[model samples]
Each structure stands twice: as structure tokens, then as C-alpha cells.
Target: MGLRGRWYRGGTSKCWLFDSKDVALHAPTREEIPALLSAAFGAADARQLDGVGGGTSTTSKAAVIWATPDADADLDYLFAQVGIGDPTVELGSNCGNCATAIALFAVQTGIVAAEDGMTKVRMRHITSGAVLSGTVPTPGGHIPKSGLARVPGSNAAGVPVNLSFHGPWGQNTGALLPTGNAVDQLQVNGRTLRATMVDAGAPAVLIPAEEAGVDLSSMADNLSGSLPTLIAARASAGLAMGLRNPEDPPQNAVPKVGVVAPAGDYIAADGTTISADSHDVRVRMLSMLAPHPAIGLTSAVAVALAASVQSSVVADAAGQAPLPGTGAPRMLRVGTPAGVIITEIISDEKGMVSEVALHRAARHIATADIDVAQAAELSA
Candidate 1:
């Protein structure tokens, strides 16, 4: 009768759910889906007065699913990153947080059989066609509702979600260095910037914190209200890094920016105190065209990738984490606006990262049925 779905907050993201059998997507056009997505997740207001966006890009998302089409993969998941402050939905991107939600969703829906300790799930992303192998903590052969691992934010400890992606270097485009160079020198707004451009979980621009005139050594509290400048810098950096039209780019898009400086102390937006002595580098990231008070899981991985590779721009920024060999996962601890996120990326002998893993604790708020009238209309 209507679009039946559930809602759950995974890490820093929230998603609207749908079962594929109940709804057949027939390659629907944008006009058919954009309006429904906008209404469900707000596009005009910062607070998303219309629905549940929470005024943050990472929090606004939609997930369309179906039974596994491949016998090898456990479930089929289509993740759409809905722009929080805009009316556009990019179906070509994957959300690490949402991906985590999908695994739990599969287990909850019984689409995936819970295993003893770790439940391995093979997920085929509808957008990039990349396959990701995810392992979750499933105690008693059931998805555990609690765990000892704690993520930087959300303050909720539940099951742990670890995902490793294969062939992610060229996720959207066709090369690790989208422009055929790890570092590119570009001019933006009359400023010269040397950048490392790479495609991992998503597209991103890695910038030296000092070059951007951002003193990462000081606490973020000392740089209060400077987010606008940082955002402008990130936008400029994104443009130089060969992003598709850095100005007025896709709403809530990737190729996020990361500014790094030598380690130092800082206060998080959540009021949590952090000392830089405990971290290798002081990092700040922007999500969806704006500087987020916290960092996204995928963004962190991209930073780790940049850090691993030695370049003119990132040469001195990264610590002494050995480059991973084939089938070996790189352990990366990124200091973000919130606190820290540990990223593990598996790479082959040729320095190609096969998969990425992010382990964090989150709360299982609630899952329920609701009617999405517009989504139903689009299907028709």
C-alpha cells in the first residue's frame, strides 16, 4: 500500500530503509526520486525542519535494498547520500556508516544468518559496483547489541562493524591518482597549493595544514569561528585537486578536505578534551562542502592513505606507519574534530588498497515501519 521502511542511526549517519522485494526500482529517473528524497530528508533548512536530517550532511542519507542478487554475496545494498542542505541525491556514492547499518539491517531482517563471533558479509554496492567484505561482532550467533570498542562520537556502544573494500583506489574514477599524479600543483583564488589527490572510500584533497595558514598546533577552541575560513580553504583546495567543478559541486559530495599539522592539544566540539601528545598528527576535515565539527569514517581512511604515501605535500605530515604489503591492512589512527577514528586498510603487494576497515561503537536507536508516500509515488 505504501513504502514501508525503518530508521536507524549508524555511527554518525541516519538512514531510511526499504526492502527491495516490496519495491521494484526499474532504473527510476532522478525526477522520480529527488522530490521524495528532499521531503524525507530536508534540503532547505540547516535543521532539516521538514524531516530528520539533523542539519548535518553525514546524518542525512537514504538506503534502498533488495534480496541478494548474487549467491556469493549475503545481501544487496544501495546507499544514496542525500544532501542535507540541498535537493540533490547522488546514487553513485557509498556511505561507510550507512554500510555498517546495512549489515545490521541484514541480520535484523534475517537476510543474513548470524554466526558465532564474526559474521562475514559480502556487499555489492549498487553505485560503484565495488564489493566490500564486512565483519561484525555477533556473539551467540546473534548481532551483539553491546561491545567494548568505543567510537569517538554517538556515546553509544553496541556491535562493532568492520568493513574492507577491494579496488577502492579508483572507486568513482579509473585511477588512484585521478589525474595520474599523487601530487598536483594548482592555483585557486590566487593562492598556490600542492595537493595529493586520491580516490579511496571517496574522492578527497589532502592539504598541508601550514600551507592553508591553519595552525593545527593550537587547540580548536583557540580557532573558534574560523571554520568559515577553513571551509573556504578546503573549497579552494578541492578545486585545485581536480575535483569536478569545486565551486557549486554536488551537494553533500565527497572529495572532502583534510588539513594536517604536527600533533597538538585541542578541544572537540562535543566539549571532550584531547591532547595532541597522544596523536601522531592533528587533523581537521570538511564534509559535504562544510567543515564538520567531527570527521567521517571514510574521510579518515583517505587521510590515512595520503599519510602512507610519501609525497612533496604529505612527506613530512605522516608518521612512521609502514606501508602495507599485499593483503596487509594499514592501521591508521586519525585525529579528527570529534576525537579519533582508527582505520584499517588492506593493500596488495603493489601498494593497492584492496579493502578498508572501520571499527566503532554506536547505539541501536530503534527500527520501525513507516509509510513514505512520495517514494511510493516515484515507484509508480
Candidate 2:
């Protein structure tokens, strides 16, 4: 058996996208699906040298897409984080970067017809039940490969995919502040640190870098040596969020850990200089316990939401003023190791977040097939 899928560059991430119908026909069972994906990505290999994986947490992902019959949605999208060293595929959350590419994949694959100018693909995440809309450029019933939109960390210019996350709160843990508090004091490695755990697009644990005893300038250089402490903090915060128990190990993906600080100069992963004045806040996030080369899309959304709340640690670190009581959209420029991700958050009259909008660029890379037998046998 073979599965037909397409490879796409979704913002800074890449994924193999399969139509749900095809998935149902070929790899139907959950256990079999992971085996197939692992085979395609060559999992259990840290480098993923023999597979399509780009050898990083960001690139080791997959998506199952389907056109929804529901009148309210145009398509349904499910994201998977394919583990590299472990034979696991987690479907606990959606990937914002991959969400951008899904709109293009749907239109190009004929699941949704492309309109003349901008095509709006209303997407629903199966895991979180959260809704979002992605606006894609279709000049002539086809997405053009060339555009003026430049996404940081992407080498080529591509069509700008504007994504709006609707009702982004509580997508993971059933509460915006999972612990029912804006901030919690957690004991990590015998030291108590105050942290904010928010569940907007994804559950996240935000802590001030200074409180973590990490200097922003040397944070990257020290990340490897400091991972144990950071992981302990995240694990403790996860307990507070109710994502795990005292005896259960922490969920590696959810409640992402981020060390934040006021805007500061830092060298990006590509060796480019990011001036402190270019952004409002500086953040370094970890996915699966490894430092993310860039901020994850869902994590970025959480950061934006956290910044909108005056009492949240993210707002305090960004030096954001208290949100106005009026209903207005606030903009935040988040500086990451890759570059800057700008997010606009809208709040109701009562200062409750209603929507979040962010822009990213994506490109359709290749359409190909993987032999199920080959993929399944690769590990054996």
C-alpha cells in the first residue's frame, strides 16, 4: 500500500500532508498510522538522516486534512508531532505554521477550489476544536510561487497567509489560566519561581529569564547545560496546569516552556543580529525539551494572548502597559531566535481576548507518494 501526500513549507516548519480520505483507505488504524509516518520520516533515528524529516523538532511533523461537510467549516485539519528518537506521534495540538500551509494544500489538491484573488479557507483543529481562518493568494485559480511576502527564517519569498485564531483561549487545558491563577509559584530543583501558565492556542509556561537565573545574552550558549533545570520547571508547571499528575511524567509537547525578557539584542540562529529596538519582547522557547530554533506558531499565539493580560508574566516581561478597558486590538512584536513574529490581539469591552491574527508565508514544495511497506520496514 502507498499513501499519497504533499510536502509543504509552512512558515518555518515542513510537514507531509495527507488527505483524510486517502488516510482512511490506506493507513486506517492509529497504531498503523504512526508506523507508516515513522517509516516515512525514518524515526528512531536522532538525525533522521534516512527519512524526509529535516532533523529537527520543527520539521518532524505531519497533518491529516479533510474537507468538512459541516456548513460552518470549509476544512478540518489535524496536526501530528512525529517523534524523532521515540516511536510516537502526538496529536494533542495544532501547529500554527502548518495551519498556514494547509489552506494552500486544500486549494491546490482540489479539496477546495481556489478563487480568483484571495481564497479564504476556514479550518478547524480536530484536537482542540478551535477554529481559524487562513487567507491565501490565488491569482489565477492557482497559488503563485512568487510573492513579496518574506517570512523570517524562510529563504524565499512566498504568498502571505494571514491566519486569524478565533476564541483562542483554553484550546488545550480547558482554561485560559489552567491553574485558575494568573501566576503560580513553582518549586523547581528546590527553588521557588513564579510562572504564568496560559492555554490559549496551546498550553504554555512563561517565566522571566532573570528569575530563571539565565542572562539573555548567553541564554542560547547555556541552553544545553540548563535544560535539566528548565525541564524541571516546565514539569512542575504542568502539574499546576493539571496536564499531568504527581506520579505521571510530564507531557513533553504541551505546556511549552519559554524564557522571556524585555527587548534585548541577540544573535539569531542564522547568525543575523536582531536589535533590541526591533521588537517589544525577547523570547526563547523549547519544544520537546529542545530549544526551538524559532518560536512555534501556537506558542506565539499564547505569548500574544499572555501579553494582552496586564497581570500575566508575559506582559510584565514585555513591559506592556495595562490593557485598555475599551474594546480594541493591541499589537505585539515578539522577537524570537529566528526573527520577529508580530501578533495582533483583539479584546472585548470587558478586556477578554476575542481573536488573534498573525501573518506567515508558505510555499507548496512537492507532491509525492510513500510506500507503506517501505516505511513500515525501515525501522525493522
Candidate 3:
């Protein structure tokens, strides 16, 4: 069978988005969605040579979208992290970068009618229960075929999308600090390390680069060598954050794990010299097992929110002063191997987050019918 879907580049990653109505034609039951997506992406093969999967953690993502009748949201999307060299389709977390793409997809496909200039669409994540608002640019009520705004990790340009999260705290574990503490001392890989486990935007754990035994200066070579250590730290944080039990195996999706460091001079992926004061915080988050080419939008929000918490590992790494108690919004500049990305954070009188906004770019890549003829035949 063929399933119709659209491809898009949102922020730093590429994702394939499909309508539930079209997916249902091929998969009659919800239980079959994972297998269907896995087959279409050639999930079992590491190279994904037989299917549309990009053979990497970032590109091997899909989401089933549909217009919602609910009052709180205009549309809903269930994100899928289709495995590479594995057949699991994880739906445990939300993705902000993909949400950026969906905003444009909605406007282009008429799911949300384009206003004259900026079109706003509110989206709800079915898995993580996060509400996102995306503003799409439409000049003369039309989404241009191309754009000039470039994402931090890529040279390619696309239409800009402004995405904001409303009340993003404690969606999964019922508190911004999942462990009831901003920082925790956990035993990982036979070493006790300090970590901050936050549940905002997405569930994530941040560790200092030194305790994680990684050198951010030589990121590429250091990350590949420290994969095993990174995995251990992530698994430990997940259990501490109550994301999983001892019986449950390690999850590659969440809580998103990474090492953080104070701003320092380093070379970016594009061979550009990044100064110490150029950004507020430095992060090297893992997508699956490897270091993500750039930070994921959901994780980026988590980092910013964690940075606001006093004395947290993320907050300590932040080179800037404490966020004001109740005043003007602040931009938290994050330094990644790709480049610098900015997230605007607004705090209320109680020092709690009022809202967090991330600016990203998205554009339509391609649309076609994906061949998943054997999807349903596989046993669920």
C-alpha cells in the first residue's frame, strides 16, 4: 500500500509528516502505526537503503497529524522516532523542530488558512501533552516556494517559524524539577555525578561536561569515544526522573541527555570561531547514541528552563547573571557545534516561567506516496 506524506526541513532536522486519514487507509488499527512507519523507513536496516529513512537519528523521524475538534488546539500530532537498525517507533516525547515544520505544513495544505502575512496555528502533542503555537510567514497570503531565513545547522534557507510553548513545565512528571530537587547526585558508570533533571518542554537531564568525562573543545572525536559513558549517564537520569522503572530498559528517546559547560571559545562545525562570550551556555546533547548535529528544539527549551533554576548544573554553566525575578524577557543564547540558537524566556513575578519562545525556520521539501506494502502484514 502507499501512504501519502510530506517531507519538510524544520530547524536543524528533517522529518516526514503524514496525515492520519491517509495512514489509516493503510493501517486500520492504531497498534499498526509503528510497524507501518518502520517498514516505510526501512527501520530494521542500519543504512535504510530500501526505504525513505535518512539512516540517521535526526532524519529518521515521522509524525501523524490531524485537525482537532478540541477547544484548546487547532491540530494534534503524534511524533514517531523511528529507529535506525531497529524497528521501534518511540512516541514518548514531543519535538519542537518538527512542530515548526507542521506549522508550515498546515498553512500550505490549508489545514490552517493563511492570513495575509503571519498565520498562527496551535498544535498539541498527543504523547507529551505539550501545546505549541507556531507562526508561519505568508506574504500576500501565500507561502513562498523558498525563503531566506537559515537554520543554525544548515546553510539552506527557508520560511521562518516562530514557535512558543505555553506552560511547558512538568508535563510528564508533574513538576518542573522531576526529582523534587534542581540538582541530584547520581551514580553513573561507577562514578557519582551531579545532574539536573527537568521536565519542562521535554524531560531531560543535564550534566557538567567534566563529570561526564567529555571535552567540548574536541567535540567530534570526544563524543564518539565517550558514547558508552554518555549512555550510562542518560539511563541513570531517566530512572531518577521517574521516566522509567528498573525493569524497563534504557530508552533512546527520553529523557533527552547531554553534557553542559560554561561558555568558552571553540570551533563550530562550519569551521567558524565561536568566542566565549558569544553564547550564554554550551550543550552537546545526544539524539540517539551519537551527539546530535545540533540541539533538538524540545531539549533546547528544557536547557533554557533548567538554566533558570538557581544552582542547577545548567544554571551554573550559564555565563550570564540570574534571570530577573519579574521584569523584561531575556534571550538565552546556546552554543552548539553547528552555531548559536536563541531562545527567549519570560518569567513571571513568582520567577516561574510565563512562556518560552524559540525562533526557527522550516520549508516544504517534497511530497509523495510512501510505499509500505508489507507494513500491515508484519505482526504487531
> What digit string (tens of lDDT, one per residue) describes model 3 on residues 45-94?
79987778999888999999989856678899999999999988898988
Residue 332 in model 3: lDDT: 94
Model 1 per-residue lDDT tens digits across residues 35-105: 55565665544576655556766677777776674576777777777766566777755777777777777
- Candidate 1 lDDT (Cα, whole model)? 0.65
For candidate 2, the per-residue lDDT at 224 reads: 81
What's each prediction's TM-score?
0.84, 0.94, 0.96
Number of the candidate with higher lDDT, 1 or 3? 3
Clashing pairs in 2: none
lDDT at residue 131 of model 3 (Cα atoms): 92
Candidate 1 local lDDT, residue 304: 65
| Candidate 1 residue runs with Cα over 4 Å from true position | 22-31, 69-72, 145-148, 218-252, 321-329, 369-380
- The full ranking of all candidates by lDDT, starting with the best, is 3, 2, 1
How accurate locally, in lDDT, is each candidate?
0.65, 0.82, 0.87
lDDT of 2 at 152: 73
On TM-score, the stronger of 1 and 3 is 3
